[model samples]
Target: MMLRPFSKSGSFYKGNLHGHSSNSDGKFSVSEVIDAYKKRGYDFTCISDHLWIDNRFCAETVTDASKYNTHNFIAINSAELHTRGKKYDKENLWHLVANGLSKDFKPSNDEENIQDLIKRAKGDGAFISIAHPEWYSLTFDEAIMLKDCHSVEIYNHASTVKCNRGSGIYIADFLLNENVKTLLTSTDDSHSLEEDAYGGWVFVKTKELNEKKILKSLIKGDYYSSTGVVIYEVKLEKRLLKLKFSSSNNIMVSGAGHTNISSHGYNLTNAELDLENFDSPFFRITISNQFGKYAWTNPYWFNELDLD
Candidate 1:
């Protein structure tokens, strides 16, 4: 089966799942952040400011449905939850992005256990995402043990801006190799417009642009993460995995045991991989342009199929 985002009927909506405002340590206010994204042609945005004592879901106060929702834009209620972890050194922390949360939802500040927080967030109907594993230098053993997370950030714009260590593809690859099913996301995690905003986003395929539909699509993995390149379609039939994309200089298929199939050229629009003889447990695709912009597809698990 194809691990694709688009279906036959729905349109694609561009959105950033992680972002911050003055409600936290971010420089921009909630209104200003919303305005910036709307002007950038984004269809929706989740103002996921930090959930802490001082911040306290401050973005909620500004997320007025009538003021932000229009024929062209939407605002989603979200937050970044940080919990104390003992697996790593004193400085290391566990950060999770909780999407589609209630405005009045309260997180336990006294909760120091990361796993417990994840469970609570899942119970609250929030889409949980492990955020910036690379930034925390999270090990595979540390990350793979966590449960109830829908996705992980393949790229975090804010982490990249601060330390140039925001990509988490290694952690993702490790989990996929272990047959743990999960999706990937690219988020701005933007705290400032100049350095972080609009750097990463996900293209969600949904029937409409409303908050509920968009969040549903996100949790269902009906999305592809991108830094700049655009993927038009991804399809799988029998043993062939095909992709239709915008201009890209390189298209690659990555899988277990260092399996890699790649095509490099100019003005490339489509690519295909024949997986009939492949034995990898899972496989995913990435497209990159000459300028280093990238788009990634969610991994397709082979063990789940009756490919006999």
Candidate 2:
């Protein structure tokens, strides 16, 4: 069965899940950060500053969600937890984005390991996302060992801005190939709007725009990640998957066991795939524009539906 987020009809709300402010290492304050995204026509934003004790205690200050919400815009309660490996190195940092955290949630002290931190976050009722595996050079073995991770970052705006190594599609694809059941997400992770902001975001389909609704949609994988492209609809019927999307230079369908199909041309807006002949365990759509920007849909697993 197709997930309710894509199968259900509703308004699409755009928002950035990862971003920083002066509360951590960002250049702007919390209010200014909210305004920056609001003026850019975003419907919601999560002020996920680095979760440290010194400067960024977002959990303490990010109370009163309505204070930052505008007429239609919303501010979600979140934070980015930075966990370091027991053996430090260039790739030792593991950044995890936690959304919809409870008010009493507390960050693990320096003595805690990455697994412990993730467990604590989940216990506090927050959605956990493994952030920028590629940038961290996270191996397939390392990624597959992560526990209770709801999603992985396919694209990270800040990592790209600072260093060109941000995309984590390979890691996500590897996990999916192992039947690890996780969603994909992209985020601006923006430290500076001029350089890193607006380059990544997630489009959530929800009946209404509010903190509870948006968080629920995210947890349910009722969303898609994008840099520029927009998908209007994704429909599955009689073993055929069809997509309606904005213009693109190419559209691709990819899955396990070398299952791949692509259409290349200008102004390509729609495509259809016949799953009757597809033997892959799952499949997903990716669209890329001439400018190299891309949009991605969550994978659809064959075992989840009664294909027989």
- For each candidate, what is the lDDT? 0.81, 0.80
| lDDT tens readout by residue for model 2, 1-308 | 34445676788899999888777777887888899999999999887877744443333333334578866999888888866672233535567898888755665556788888888888777778888787778777778767369899999998887899789888888888888888899998888778989999999998999888888888888899999999877777777777778888888888885788877889888877677777788888899988888999988787775654
CA error at residue 170 for candidate 1, angstroms: 0.7
Least lDDT summed over 10 consecutive residues: which range in candidate 2?
55-64
lDDT of 1 by residue, 1-308 (tens): 43457543689999999988787777887788889999999999988877744344344332332356788898888888766663563534567898887777675465547788888778778888888888878888787766468998999988888899889898888887777788899999998889888889999998888888887888878888999999987777778878889999999989986988888889899988787777687888899998889999888777655554
- Quickly count the clashes in candidate 2: 0
RMSD of each: 2.6, 2.4
TM-score of 1: 0.91
Regions of model 2 farther than 4 Å from truth: 1-4, 53-66, 86-91, 306-308
Q: Model 2: which residue pairs collide? A: none
